[model samples]
Target: MRKLTDFEKQVIEQKGTERPYSGEYYQHDVKGVYCCKKCDAPLYRSESKFNAHCGWPAFDDEISGAVKRNIDADGRRVEIVCAECEGHLGHVFEGEFLTPKNVRHCVNSVSMVFKSALEVVAPVKKTELATFGGGCFWCTEAIFSTLEGVNSVVSGYAGGSATDANYRAVCSGMTSHAEVVHIEFDPDVISYESLLAVFWQSHDPTTLNRQGNDSGPQYRSVVFIHSDKQAESVNAMINTLTKACVWQDPIVTEVAAFDGFYPAEDYHNDYFELNGEQPYCKIVVKPKVDKVKALFAELLKSN
Candidate 1:
């Protein structure tokens, strides 16, 4: 059992309600399971989540035998609690017709913690890492983040000698770091070779140390392969692209052995998604993102 924070105790133990729409899981949409914050027992599946717009996380159903209902202290509302630990969840309402189920389990986000589907099913679905520097980490991160099997995409710097590298130092072109996106993906769903294809197609690998107007060593086209098998796959793909004359100029993409990666500043993490209305994203990032979505529609996650 996890130690409950003061606020968690207020909600889970004392049966107090959290502020509407203020809970962490109120707007969360990641594919995962939400477990009891007190006992760590699974309580809700992500698929069961819905936008009740009532400021609390709402679900039409609960995991079978996972939740129990009891008369609330007010006697007017029925309260739901974790079946495993009897920790307070929230109220359950019926006959609202929100879904075919006609049921809504209004839940407190603070009473539960989310676990990604990958984490829940890791024993059967192992994940792998792939890192690439196609251009701006912002652009690369956005592109791969939309893929189906991709679990997470992190914007970072790779292929640098410095023990510590920051965006400012790398952008100065003195750090030798290239803006990169570190990807965690389920190889069973999307193979490493499939990711390499996207990396090659997403940017002009032929260009030397530059992508579009973004010029500097920091913007170089590079791959930091984690294994010899990965190295072989990349080399083979490069050879195939060269033979097919995919690009007019010689491919200058640097393929290096996996070293270390330094994550970029927090603000740069989801630049395109968070700041899509910004001028640079509209002019520089959106088109590339759209092009990849169109070209690789089959590989994308279903919305």
Candidate 2:
């Protein structure tokens, strides 16, 4: 079982309520699954959340069989708890008409933990890895993380020597390393070509060593292929995009052989999701994320 902080114990064990509008997830708007803090059971989808002006994170739905509801001891409110562990999750209210469902799940922010679609690392019987650098790993991570078949998208450095893989060295633009994501995916659910498509469409391959205000060798566009088959698929997709006149400028994206990928520092792995309110995430990552969510809606995992 996951260890709980004092605040979590208060709200989850003692059935406490966090101050309105103070919860971390109260205003969160990212695509991913929310799970029980105590048991890690899947609870809610980002799509089901809406602002109810009630100071708590409001949801209109929960993942099937993930939650159980019962009347509170006072017999005035319905309390929702994690089905697997019976962890306290606040209360559910109905007939509010706040959303199309006409129901609201008033959940404490501390009651659950969010697993952004980009950070899910579910183990599968079969899986494959694809590595690509398309500017900032934070943006790239956000884009690919939502895809249906992707198991996990890890932000890291590649196409560079191991000694200089650290973020500070890469940021200096002296190392050959480029910020990249190592994606673990299931080919049966999403093909390599589809991932490549997202890679190309989500960023400007035309820019040589920069993406918007960010410019450096570390931000260059590159695809590091893991196998001959991956190389062929990437080539074919680039050819198709070229034939369709997707960009006015010639694509400068380099297709390189798979090299060692050094996972980024711990804090950088889910920078965008964990630090969404930061200026960089709010200003740069969110817009790109919104675009990816819209363009690849069908590929996103359903909550």
Candidate 3:
């Protein structure tokens, strides 16, 4: 963990607020991730931040499950804190109409440290690829991206016949494509079997072509294996899970040969990271991410 400065200690530990418009990030615009100063848990993304002209830096969203909300001791406003370390993070206000999200997270700049995306993604040594589709790529990507050995997770469409596969074309449910994530990881640090375990636990494979509110062929549960060995491994895991009666419903997750993967547009690469405050991310993605963190705490990156 990084050592916190006195100012950061005051704001994050003592729950003090910075002077209005005085914080460094108030007028700063940078594409990166804002992590908690105390524990380095990712808190917010630069894209969700907006100028609220409220003195302190303002964000319209936070990384899913990164911050927790509680009523103030005074019983008036809501206080936000880092979910991982319980460090103070200022407050949250709703219905302000400050942005399309209609929410504002008034945060003290000292409570966070910014890391550009380039710095966050480390260079890989002999990386391997894994592709999977479990409902929405937004949720799947968010889950796998936090794992210890994962180098990158790109949202994309796979197993489709459509030559021109795009979000709009896939969403129409006629393209036969399922929203998938192309993961690049280091096998030396994390085994493919471990990744397979995460895949089974992260989403319900029994549900045919649906996950939560979003339902279509694009949301199907699938594992696109890159090799024959991968296929055998997936089948073995499925058989074990089935014998264990992990779910009352029969396992329906598809294990198929590898196919071409069409990467989604740039905006979709980090959907949960960028739009976590949005209703879909908040309601659908957050809980699943929290569960993954709890279940796979040993596999997560330290930071």
Clash number for every model? 1, 1, 1
Model 2, position 21, has a per-residue lDDT of 85
Better of 2 and 3 by TM-score: 2
TM-score of model 3 relative to the true fold? 0.58
lDDT of 3 by residue, 93-132 (tens): 9998999999999999888889998878744569889999
The deviation in Å at residue 96 for candidate 3 is 66
Instruction: Provide the lDDT at 12 for model 2.
Output: 96
Candidate 1 global lDDT: 0.91
Instruction: For each candidate in the order shown, give its overall lDDT on alpha carbons.
Output: 0.91, 0.91, 0.90
Name the regions of candidate 1 deviating beyond 4 angstroms. Answer: 1-124, 298-303
Query: Model 2, range 129-191, lDDT digits (tens) per residue?
Result: 999999999999988887889999999999888988999999999998999999999998888
Q: Which stretches of candidate 2 lie over 4 Å from their true place?
A: 1-124, 298-303
Find the 10 residues in a row with the least total lDDT in model 2.
Answer: 294-303
> What are the per-model C-alpha RMSD values against the true structure?
14.4, 16.7, 14.3
Highest TM-score model number: 1
TM-score of 2: 0.58
Clashing pairs in 2: 118-145
Candidate 1 lDDT by residue in tens digits, 54-156: 9999999899999999999888999999999999999999998888999999999999999998889634668999999998888999899888899999999
